[model samples]
Target: MTGLRERKRARTHAAISEAAIALFLERGFDEVSVAQVAEAAEVSKRTLFAYFPAKEDLVVHRFADHETEAARVVLARPPDAGPLAALRDHFLDGLRRRDPITGLNDVPEILALTRMVVEAPALRTRMIRFQEASERALAEALQDTAGVPALTARLAATQVVGVHWLLSMDNSRALLGGQSADERCPAAVADAGHAFALLSEGLAAHL
Candidate 1:
């Protein structure tokens, strides 16, 4: 169980993030300043910076929750399950839930955040960095779990990360183009199945 101090910290962290995102969505990411976010959150600039080291971080920190998610999925797979199988199943599950991380969510807030990230150069760049960190985490997990060499693990991570990113991008484009998540569900599932099948075939020989 979390202690009172930890719970309070979590609440404060969430409050800051919520305030920052609301401001960014309303006034635009670039237009909103750090001081303004701190004021809105009712925290000092020092406290806000303590929670988020950078302005781009205030927007991108949500992505941080999933930075090591792929790695965790791989590590926690059933004894007989292959890494790719676990990952594919996890992503499919996310789609079923309309997970915002899967880019299949049509929630207005999620759509606004996605558009904001796409339009803001800094956010885009920071998101790319998050992707890079995710790839690294997955690579390490692959190396540890599959006992593959570093180079091979890295190569596999690159492929897996790229495929997932492309699939998510396709989903986002469909929704942003006016297609609902329910309408896009079939294509998204089919695409995931096909992509994972291709990956399984390629990775089988290597692993």
Candidate 2:
């Protein structure tokens, strides 16, 4: 059945991603080839490429959900919810769930992946580029849902995404600095909540 096939595909994709991340953490991202990841996952290199077009994607696949999430939040916001308020609510919910995007899911493997990305120049460049693309997608969604001016929507999207990027980097730093997940996650959640509140209230007050 179509549903069963989709579920199987999802499982395969998750297995490949998990295997790729483990290998990347063991060997540097640059040092690990697609062939090696395929071997580790027990899939053909062609199959791996069919699932993830690029090597960087294998490590950063989780981030591919952001654009969809941002769009969904804006689209599903209550009638009374402003764009900023909707985003704030969404992020707060994510923080409470300790979502990986919010940096509250600071597992050791995630820390290692963060370190791998930080140390790799190419991965860093690609990440910035990916962020820009995600921002554009979010901006378009916000503009559609909120009927905001193009410039304003883009600016708002940039600010929101930038804040998220900062929180993610901060969480990684805290973890790498030897903080326990239990100790660091709550602080990151608090910081993210304060950050979103400041954004909602207007940055002029904080700046």
Candidate 3:
């Protein structure tokens, strides 16, 4: 169970993020300053910075939650489960749950956040960095698995993560075009199946 102090801190953190995102969505990402976000959240500039180290972070903080998710998925898979199988299953599950990274979420506020990230230059660059970090972490996970060469793991990570990136963009486009999650889900699932089938061609022999 979380202590009072920790719960209070979580509430404050959520407040700051919510305030920052609302401001950015209303006024645009570049126009909203850090001080303004702090004021709106009823926190100090120091506290805001403590929660989000950079301006781009306010919008992209959610990405931090999944920074090493691929690694964790791969590491925790059953002994007999191939790495590719684990990833494919994980992504498919995300699609079912309408996970944001899977681009299956149709929530208005979530769509707004996606638009904010897509339209902002800093957020785009930071997103690329986060994707790279995820890939690097997955590569390390691959290396830790037996019979997988370091180079092979790196190559595999790149190929796998590339598919995920493309899927996210496709889902975002469909959502922004006004498709709801229920409408987009079948296609999303189909697309994911196709993607993994294609990946398995070159990657099957390796994993």
Best by TM-score: 1
Tens digits of per-residue lDDT for model 2, 109-131: 66677788878887888789778
Candidate 3 lDDT, 1-207, residue by residue in tens? 469889999999899989988899999999999999999999999998988899888877778878888889999999999999999999999999999988889888889989888888899999988989989999999999746898999999988888998998899989999899899999999999999999999899988
Clashing pairs for predicted structure model 2, backbone only: none
Q: Quick one: ranking by TM-score, best first?
A: 1, 3, 2
Candidate 1 ranges with C-alpha deviation above 4 Å: none
Candidate 2 stretches greater than 4 Å from native: 1-8, 185-190, 201-207
Model 3 spans with C-alpha error above 4 angstroms: 1-5
| Residue pairs in candidate 3 whose N, alpha carbon or C atoms collide under 3 angstroms | none
lDDT of 1 by residue, 57-92 (tens): 988888878889989999999989889899999999
Best by lDDT: 1
Candidate 2 structure lDDT: 0.80
lDDT of 3 at 21: 86
